[model samples]
Target: MRKTALFAALSVTGALLSGCGTAERLSRIGRAPDMAPIADPTRDPNYRPVSMPMPAPQDARNLSANSLWRPGSRTFLRDQRASAVGDIITILVSIRDQAELQNTSERSRENSESMGIPRILGLDSSYARFFPQGFDPSRMIEANSNNGSQGTGRIRRNEAVTMRVAGTVTQVLPNGNLVVTGRQQVRVNHEMRDMQLTGIIRPQDIASDNTVQHDRLAEARISYGGRGTVSDVQQPRYGQQILDAILPF
Candidate 1:
């Protein structure tokens, strides 16, 4: 009885919490989603400095007399690409993937056994008194077993995405690699689409147009999702989701 009461209380609490969120969304039923204010990314509590392994420092090579170019410089003229912290650059995101898999297996087993006391001292004659009529001591015990199992699995997936967003260089690692982060939000009617990207990039990978491809990024993280009336309707109810999680088959 106590366990039942505790479970009921927890369910009530979860429903109340879910209701609060629904009420907030309901208040904006007819209005468009509000845009977030622009702020400093470095000021966010979750933001941290990036660290990476660095190669041993090398001495700068002396340039030839009267030479216009400097050692370790990509261009003779001033480079316009993003190389310092806080610089902005464009990111080209393109992805296309597909996968298919199938597997099958079958197993079977069978066993049989027989045991008997054909002769035990001179007491074999007494079996007729305690055993069934016409008892056969040669086959007193017998057992047979058979088991079989079969399984099959299959999976198929396909995905594609393309977008362009500007990212800010958040940190310059000791090895000269830059850490970049960006976010984009678009609101149409009552629905809002959101995209976030973060990764480490090399300065040399940036093209002459100040843009870098997604493939050039290392340790990349990309997210694309949306929230609105249609999205909420498509999701299962809080109570149903909770039951699906806790109920045992």
Candidate 2:
């Protein structure tokens, strides 16, 4: 009875501690757990390791164990499907995009004023002795101004890419989606082409011939391009780029 009571009290304490240290626990999300010679939290005061959720490997089951390959069996005519890591799947890349924009602005403003003295008041003649020979009271009260501005801009862009690359499944998710990654590099004379891709795909999306379109992949990232001596020559110098960013004139 005493041991049972002690166990219940320890369980309650553990629940309370975990509930209060939620954020503290998340701080070690990316850290590796303690390896060999696993230390007890109470026995090794200096040893500390973190625990976090991690993706588990897919369960591999052997279907051949129960299925037989008879001369006229349906299994004999089944198509090969990519459902595991290391399986290769062809990806068809197709992309086309275009954009165009134009902007224009214009502004104009003008102002003018004038004042004249009445001859009956004689106020203009009262200050005649202190005024310059060519000075006029009416002209001193007049002002005129004019301002105008015009701006225009235009931009156009077009991009088209089409190619094919084979990708290998690097991981299989619990839901049966495959995480794929692929890279291709080709060299021709003085030029080189580099291509890379990564994404997730469902087995059902794969064609009977073991091929999948790039647009069918989820979270897909595909990049294709080339670089060589000719490319370097076409690029602007670093100094020029910095000047473009900093100079207004």
lDDT of 1 by residue, 64-141 (tens): 898887655666766778999889999999988889999999999999999998999999988888876688889989
lDDT (Cα atoms) of all candidates against the true structure: 0.88, 0.69
> Candidate 1: what lDDT?
0.88
Q: What is candidate 2's TM-score against the reference?
A: 0.54
Which residue pairs collide in model 1, if any? none
Best by lDDT: 1
Candidate 2 per-residue lDDT over residues 33-144, each given as its tens digit: 2223422222345422223234676676545656556332224656576778778788888888899999999999998878765453666666667775656655566778
TM-score of 1: 0.86
Model 1: per-residue Cα lDDT at residue 112 = 100
- RMSD, one per candidate, in order: 3.2, 19.6
